[model samples]
Target: MANVSYFEAWGMWFDGRSTPGNDLLGLSMIWWGRFGKILSFVAGAAVIVDLLGPSRLSRYSDRLTGFLARRTFMATAGASFVAAITFLWITDPIGMHRLLQSVLCLTFVTAAGLLVTAVSRALPATHRVIRAASRERVVG
Candidate 1:
């Protein structure tokens, strides 16, 4: 399983309908080097929380949130690609792709950080707009 192909690795990583060992969640055996499954679950949960935040898109600020969400999605996908490359390389599927992995992770992490900042910056503005709109509706 260590030197499995990219297609097979992906099948294990994604396909829920696959057999027991083929499941992506079953990948702990191969890449459980440090952080372990708990960390992975936390990371996945954080991404979901960010995507499903309470901000409604009807507000002007939610537009920025949408932008942030799109950018974050791309950054995360890029990171996933890099991580898969690293995993494959480390597993001897190809060789040591550590350098490529590091580079890809670094780039995507920076992009993600910037997108997070953009979302943060818009939060206050969005909140203010929503509050004002509410106040106006109540008054009228």
Candidate 2:
């Protein structure tokens, strides 16, 4: 059994391996975990503020909420598709390979495209929030 150590800062466990790939994977996991936590907190706070505060925190003028929701759905669907394919391949690789040759591969490509588009849409919101917060910090 491999020994695992937990890192408080990263909020993750890591095996005692010094390999480059392991280090990179650990770092990426940490980054994603932190990013997700921060984003969730920010989004939750925004909702609370919008509900309770006299003035709205930030309002999107361009139907961005719908666009983001749609993009999020696409990304989620794409991820689910890929997950199902992975499970199918694990259960029956030969059958999965044959199916992939027919249509699964194309579907995988489409899912990847959706993921890319979703990522593109997601980044701007993060940047916009960061900019707004910085301005508020400076002004207030």
Model 2 scores a C-alpha lDDT of: 0.57
RMSD of each: 13.3, 11.8
Which residues of candidate 2, in runs, are more than 4 Å off?
1-94
Which of the numbered candidates is closest to the native, going by highest TM-score? Answer: 1
- Model 2: how far is 124 from its true place, Å? 2.4
Give, for candidate 2, the lowest lDDT window spanning 10 residues: 53-62
Worst 10 residues of 1 by lDDT: 17-26
Q: What clash count goes with each model?
A: 1, 0
lDDT of 1 by residue, 7-92 (tens): 66667658753333332444633354345677988999888755754344235465655665567656556665665565555655
Model 2: how far is 47 from its true place, Å? 21
lDDT of each: 0.58, 0.57
Clashes of 1: 1
Clashing pairs in 1: 12-24
Per-prediction TM-score: 0.34, 0.31
